[model samples]
Target chain A: MKPAAFKYIAAESLAQALALKAEYGDEAKWLAGGQSLVPAMNLRVAQPAVLIDLNPIEGMAGLTVKEKPTSEPHALVIKAMTRYRTLERSAEIATHCPLLHETMPHVAHPQIRNRGTLGGNLAHADPASELPAVMMVLNAKFKAQSVRGERWIAARDFFYTLFTTALAADELLTEIAIPLQPDTPTARTRTCFMEIARRRGDYAMMGVAASVTLDANGVCTDAQLGYLNAGDTPILATQAAQSLVGQSISAAQIQAAAAIARDEVQPPGNVHATVAFQRHLATVLTKRTLTTILDFRF
Target chain B: MLCKDFSLRFEMTDVTQKRCFVLFVIKMSQTTCPPKLLQIQNLKSKIPMSDLHTITATVNGKSYTRTIESRMLLSDFIRHELGLTGTHVGCEYGVCGACTILYDNHPTRSCLTLAVQANGHRLETVEGLAVSPTQLHPLQQAFHEAHGLQCGYCTPGILMTMKAFLAENPHPSEAEVREALSGNLCRCTGYQHIVDAVLNVKDEG
Candidate 1:
């Protein structure tokens, strides 16, 4: 369980970290929280020759909520190294992005969350992880910086397949920006996060992040169901979501959408769950999540 | 996780076929991996043995500086480097909470953390809990009274984790206490007595 030998450099600034990434390229890895990376290193699954520690970089870890102008949607900026514990207790998140606030506790245990970062979890793009699904449903954007320049990758375009992402070798995920519901009384948005795990802190067998916006007449204007462990990447049930739009969130609509969601996924089976069971979970979670959203009297 | 798709439905009737399957597993773990990985490892990179990093941190309120390999785990630094063996190691991966310690007053898994990452940070291990052998910490005394431990192996970690847990929530309900203990795993005891021990601590102090 010992990690392979490597040169560690605690980058003092963002510029230094980017320069180090450019220098080492594929041979180096930017260490954020080290909750996932170190475990892989200990298993000898990931063996990068150089580890550029980004913790020491100033202004790299924080959370901020920006209330936009009257017509613009509000935004939440979370720096890459901002730990999960911080997000768990953030009042701003609870008020703005309720789905993310609810999903925080399901990421991992308190011990792992104390060291795990939001950016690290998203960039990892694990099929079984919860944050990626949350990010996808919330319409978040990731900022990737390198020696060349910085670029913004949309949440939909960020994750490619499996553990792979659109991130380049020399790029470092700087921060994540999630759009929040507009601060208007008429803008009705409800979100729910739920997962079924054998143990409390174990990796979930199936998880869902569901969000819905209703018009003044209680008709669904938009809907999204982001699922983890359901496909090669974070599966955004587009067809399922489209079925909900323009219809009242009744038992029929919810069941129809859930069925579509169950069929849209290509869930891989494991010892804990079979392909049939995972599909069943997807259907049940989707219906329950949408049912919960319907109960919210907006 | 990368090898989740590797099907084991092949017939293993011969040794040659079994050997080929083992080699394929190794290849999936190391060497050329699937296209899912961001880093394409075609060239085998050398592990730099001589590159040592200096870490200056306060462990259990005592200042210490050590130059060691950057890949050295924080749990090993506490046990081997600082000679604080009270911190136990179960699963080196972050799943088991046996290597839990307080990093900057937050209960953190030292196994998943690198020693070099602890530079200029504050770490509290299990050895720092008691003042002496005769006078155990109040929580430890409560455990001794309530029979919280059986094998006594996962005690240090559970105590360290609860030390921070109780600090955050001084008066927690039984369900809340169980939720806080979700990270720490105990094999021998069914956690009924361990939960009793933690609840007993709140009554005394």
Candidate 2:
């Protein structure tokens, strides 16, 4: 079916988009990349009277990395509007964060990535999506701006509920800053991402992201674990993380963490899977992610 | 009570032409024919509409543009607007690859994109899959020789998808071909013949 007629305006700058959004309130929607919005409009789920297309806005799309002082670790800063295609092509993503590079190719397809922005995907915040879960595990921060002012929202706090974010209506996500995982001399951090879907390239029914930091003594100093489609938002299994921290990545420790993760998640039963099956998958995927990371073959 | 009777009014302006019109419609289905509806409908009929939204892009080697409604999908835009009806539309919700087209030099679901979105973008449809009007492209020829298509509804999109798949990976294995065309669905052919067709086309000079 065709969408209802609506007015379209291409915003030239960030200020214009904010002004239009503030003026129209819920009647308007900011069109960034249009990967999610266009489909929603076609399905009649969203029919904004006015669409403030932000593709032409200047200075909103770019990618760059900043190295900290010679003593400290570097910061690989990815702009919010940067397309996934850019991330896939960037030598920086491959060099600094090879795990992120490996995960980017599995996001939809090349055509969708050519237009889908990082900010748009995060903002959409589908529970079954991999990007939001990855962002949470990576501790990325979102920089948002509105006509009134600008603020930084941590990934942990940015996601409030299903499809809900801390972003104000007038605010536009302008940047995503990922602190480069430090490279220690003695012990290296291992990370991995995996998802199970009914069909390849489709949204995941259950997925996991894991980061494990080992000390010189081969003991886990820190662990970060995240699961998608397991709750209202991407939930971090703190219990699972705690179970692995300060312990060696032994079979028993990994099993204990996976068991805790399975008990911690309360995934909804959608068309893809049953609640019991998803909980089981959470355990299996958690074990798989941890094993992949510890083996340094992720 | 009054909440059920509430209606919202919005003004829509044509992007190409700076013409504006007000539209008011009641959301709830207790319709007694709102007077505002008639006024908007009458105003819409009065304007001398231009088919300016008709897009111009090169399909294969030829360039053409025709007037299209703002709501006309890119899939329909290629099939009807350009009079090259080789492209098919199935499961218009972007899942079925029957509407796949080479958009901006990549395989994209035309059904998922608006015609206006392709305003200045280069596009290639199934009509582009030919050496000449009388000759078939390698993929098309392979499909025929392999008996890859039965109903042929999904053949155009499969061919276009394979063409893009081969451009980047000229020597992909059988599994790679399956991974690339997973988005396209075919009911008649169990996709074995289609997979063989892609493999055979890769061997063409």
Candidate 3:
């Protein structure tokens, strides 16, 4: 019931942490909050020689609203280092971006939320995680930095496979930018997130995030849906989104999109839910999520 | 792998047929750790710290510093180091809630947390219950009144979890308590008495 011995250092700053990472290469890990890293270390699944604790690193946590590159309503720029608790506590996010708020509470217990960081969660890159799915739906931009330089990676291309991201070994996730969509008279935008898990605080068996935007004529202008625990990476339901665009919100159209999403995902079998059941749940949840999004009286 | 051999004397044929029930209750007290740290004099050795890393933390209302190995977990610090053995270590990977403790009013798994992580944090263990050494906290009293414990290995963890849960939502309904305790598993008492204990806390207040 004890972990194997390892050295630990509470890094003074991000630069120091990155320097340590660069010195140790893959043998060193940056420990933030320890919600995920601690569990992995205790399980002996991940054994690093030294851990550069990031808790002491200043100015690395917070939620900030930034200006997007384009005037497009869907383009929102949200900072990445935001804590889940900060987002969960934000009334603005709840009112403006209810999909993000809805999915935040399902990440883990409140205690874990107090310590878990959005950057760590995204960088950990569990396909079943809510943030990854939400990021995909938002088409968020990730800014990764190292001792050398920085680069932006799109959410779609960021997550390559299970527990894998485009991030290099030494790089740190600095920020995430999400597009902003204002609920105005001109643009009737709707969003909903739904998931089915065996127990609370457990990973989702199947989850869906849907963002539906409609024109004045009630024709779907754009649709972006993200599926979690349904594939190797957080996948965008392109077929589902395509099936809904330019079409009126109809049960038939929703069904077609659900079918497309269900057929598209290659869900792996796990103890929480089977592949077939997960596929079925994906269809059911996608339809339900869309229905909730469309049912908004705004 | 190194070779090892040992002999165990038992009439398996006779014992097996008599009772399958007794098998599960057998408690093994053998220590998994080595008895003493032996120095390999002939080997090239970079002398490590003579004393293990010392961690200072406030437990309950008392503060103490204990020397612990780098591998020592918070649960081990609370249990073996400080002799507050109430905190049970189970499913060391942090999935099981048997090692849950209140670290500065936040519930955390001690098994998954390092002792060094608690340096400046306030940790309240199951031993923190009761004002003095003799009295029982409301939750602990309720457990006894409701017969909440059978094989009490999980009792301390259950008490710690219930205490925190009640602090947040004092008058939680039966279903709410059930949802809150979903992370902590108890193999004995069918969880009926544990539920009863938490329900008693709600009624008492």
Candidate 4:
């Protein structure tokens, strides 16, 4: 397959990229990493008239820990072009956002991660992608910039629908800011990620990312679980997660939550997994993830 | 060795009078005859300047600057433009991982990227994996010894991918090697000997 003839321009600065986006409007596609977009282009599924290459923008492919004055949670600000391989290798990701670190291996193959950007994946909003679910579980905020200005979109509200985002056509996702879980013992956070695919590295039939913030007495203060391939978008199990809050999350409660999660998810059947089988996987993975998080020595 | 002083000069004259482009690849110090210049015929004559991009990139330690169509994938550029055909293209959509190459020290799917994107980037293909004309890199040697490939079509991409994998992992367990190889699809060897081939290499780290 071959991509159609298009005008390609590499933007050297963020301002230049925004200007190009403003100038070209919806006919232009912002090229970051091109891991997913280029493949769609090659398949003739997406035929943009202009591709604004964002790889060359200065200071656009790194991460920094932005600390607050102890009252507010610190943030891990990852530039838009930061590669997934970098996030996987970074000690900061493991420390600051364990859910993302654990889910990195399941995102794609190492080769794809070597070039795929977190911003690109999040912006692409693939319902089956691991990053969007993990980002949702992490409660990360996405920074969208345009020639007009910049605005922050919460991770939970970012994904609008299938392969779509809340982002406007002229807006480019510049960075992703994940608030670091405060290490205060009064509310310690632990996360677990798991997915079941027909084959390793393929999109999962079902996947779950669970984050639990336990109080000093081991009571669940906050339980956030995000599921991929469960619906039209990355689905957050609000009811299932709410069942664990303000309780010890006993084995029975875990089972109940799993059942609720299974019932709540609306999975599309594929050749690999039937609708019933996908619901079963949701039950199994939900229970397994909850149990794993509870079992971890906090 | 013979192209130590190689230079390519594009004659930009007569674009209005004649729309064709004549590229003169001058093989320097190869006798002062007129036949020494290899002419690349009609390089995108009718294409507008906006649709064609002149990009310079280094591959296998050799630099090439060519005006290519914007839609040309990096895999096509390496094969058709530079003639480094060692990197195979099994699936153009980056699924098969047969078009893998090292872009700026990271192994990437060349088919998923445009040649215009390779501007100012360093690329290493399967052809660059040898120490000399008579010598193979240790991984290639291990693959040869272990019979890692059967059809050999997917070997180039696998070699390039594994080269980067081994570099990063240094010493990986059998399971780790298999996990790293999950990105690449190989039908012939069932991945046993491919894993064996990877395990055979000794990482200095």
Each model's lDDT comes to 0.83, 0.75, 0.74, 0.84
**Sort by DockQ, top down from the best:** 1, 4, 3, 2
Selected candidate, larger TM-score, 3 vs 4:
4
Residue B169, model 3: Cα distance from true site in angstroms: 3.2
Residue A280 of model 3 has an lDDT of: 97
Residues A1-298 of candidate 3: C-alpha lDDT, one tens digit per residue: 3455567777888788888877765556677767777776675545556667777677887665554455654543454456677788887678767788888878876556656788889988778788899999987889988898889999889887656678877888888877678766557778888888766766777889999989888888899989888776887889889889989889988998999999988886554467899899989999998988887644
Candidates 1 and 2 compared: the better one by DockQ is 1
Model 4 lDDT per residue over B78-151, tens place: 99999988889887877788999999988899999999999999999988999998999999999999999999
Candidate 3 per-residue lDDT, tens place, B31-59, comes to 34221111111111332322256778999
Candidate 4: lDDT of B145?
95
Worst 10-residue lDDT window for candidate 2 chain B reads B13-22
| Candidate number with greatest TM-score | 1
Backbone steric clashes in candidate 2, count: 0
Residue clash pairs of candidate 4: none
How high is the TM-score of chain B in model 4? Answer: 0.75
Provide the lDDT at A155 for model 1.
91
Cα lDDT of model 2 by residue, B78-147, tens digit: 8777777888887665556788888887788787677767766788888777889889888889999999
The runs of at least 3 residues in candidate 2 whose Cα sits more than 4 Å from the true structure, single-residue gaps closed, are: A70-72, B1-56, B61-69
What DockQ results for candidate 4?
0.20
Looking at model 1 chain A, which ten-residue stretch has the lowest summed lDDT?
A180-189
What are the models' TM-scores? 0.92, 0.85, 0.83, 0.89
The C-alpha stretches of model 1 lying farther than 4 A from their native spots are A183-185, B1-46
Output the lDDT of residue B196, model 3.
93
Clashing residue pairs in candidate 1 are none
